[model samples]
Target: MTIKAVVFDFGGVLIDWSPEYVYRQLIPDEAERRWFLTHVCAMDWVVRQDGGQPIAEGTAELIAKFPEHEVLIRAFYERWQEMIGGVLDEGAATVEKLDAAGVPLFGLTNWSAETFPYAWETFPILRRFKDIVVSGRVKLVKPDPAIFHEMASRIEPHLPGIEPHEIVFIDDNRKNADAAAALGWHGVHHTSAAATEARLRELGLPV
Candidate 1:
């Protein structure tokens, strides 16, 4: 079937979100790096931020847990900005191609509300999307069908004639992409902009 829309994941796909980018900058000492990753990274406190916990509250909770490393904890919370650079120009160009070809575009990401505005500011191309579903604002994360269902619901009203399978969801996380595929949407595990463009081309969409 011809794809009607393409959904993108922001972090690993459009923007550079390498944790090491921030860790190397903040924790210069190898010992401190290992310690921070072991105690803090493993906790996955960012999940709370994505799960609708306020940034201030989440940062405070993390600080309380690691009272001795308050500065490190704060740095970790603010490190998202450091990790984010401008969108991949090639990816932005591909999105433009897809849009010009009449394929609807949307963003489905597990991003915090606190960071979304910054992303919008950094990537002006994002405004071209018809819709965006951010986990922090919705209070639901991906791989949980609720978020997918919410996205489907929002697009369904706009595309009453389209089938669920017509929406191609592109995400870097295999689990989330698999979950979306299982729910009857077309899923693409994004490896690279080139690879994704190839897949879209296969679907008869110009990318």
Candidate 2:
């Protein structure tokens, strides 16, 4: 099938965001930071916020569960902006290339509604995409077929009757890439900017 649009997963692919950035400075000890992140401010816990749980509510609930770590828990959301490392140059360049080539661009990201505004305001490259489907906005995260379906529905207004096979999805997580592939779309597991761009070219995209 001829590809008609490019769907990008913003966090790992185009933007460099990791909780470690915030914790590293606060918890200088590597082991302690790992322990805190793994047992307390875990990925699962963070995903809940990405799925639409209010940031304040999530933070309060976490502090309640680990009263001793109140300060740490507060820091998680308090210093959330530090987690965004900024737009990745090489990766974002690919988006620019595609856009300049006249390819339709869109974004699908698992980001907290409460925090995404910071990045949205900070990065100009993000604004290039014609449309974006944010997990927090819709309360559905990636790897869940529902989120991809939501993306498809949103893409309809721009590319009418577009099929899954006609879109290429780029995600850094293998699970997300596989999930989209399972749904019949061409999913590229982005390991690096060079690799992803190579794969996109192989898929017949101008970039």
Candidate 3:
């Protein structure tokens, strides 16, 4: 089927999101870093926060779990702004090209609501997309079919004549790309913007 919409994952695709960068910046001491990562940097805490749990509550729960590191935990949660950065210019340009071609653009990202505005401000190109389905806003993170379905529902309505298969989903993570592919959408495991643009051209999409 011909491509209709091009859905992009924000983190790792548009913007570089590395937890290690944050870890290194915040927890400079090697011994302290190990402890914080093992005990305090809880995935559940991140999930709960993304699921719309109050930040204070998530921080408090984490603090309660690891009382010794409560100060660092609070600092990490509060100073999230120091971690995130902007999207690369070349990638942003590619997205702009796709948008200009009348290809419906959308974002399906596992991004925190608290940090999205920071990302948006940093990457001005994000404003061009027709729709943005964030996991934090929807409370459904990807690798889960429901998040993909949620995105599909929102995108399908916008492209009235197009089927779900016509949407091309791109992400840096193989699992996410594969999940999208399994759902009958075109999925690209992003390596470089040049390669991705070539793939779009192969699909007869005006990149």
RMSD of each: 1.8, 0.9, 2.2
lDDT of 3 at 103: 83
Screening candidate 3 with a backbone cut-off below 3 angstroms (N, C-alpha, C), the clashing residue pairs are none
Better of 2 and 3 by lDDT: 2
**Clash count in backbone of candidate 1:** 0
Best by lDDT: 2
Q: Check candidate 2 and list the clashing pairs.
A: none
Worst 10 residues of 1 by lDDT: 39-48
Q: Total clashing residue pairs per candidate?
A: 0, 0, 0
Q: How accurate locally is residue 169 in candidate 1, as Cα lDDT from 0 to 100?
A: 90
TM-score of 3: 0.88
After the best TM-score superposition of candidate 1, give how far the Cα of residue 45 lies from its true spot, in angstroms. Answer: 1.5
Candidate 1 has an lDDT of 0.82
How would the candidate models be sorted by lDDT, starting from the highest? 2, 1, 3
User: lDDT by residue for model 1 over 92-191, one digit each (tens)?
Assistant: 7888888888888898999888888888887878887889999999999988999998888778766887787798898888998999999998888988
Candidate 2 lDDT over residue span 1-207, tens digit each: 479999999999999999899899989999999999999999999999999999999999998999999998999888898888888999999999999999999999999998888888999999999998888899999899999999998899999989889999999999999999999999999999999999998888887
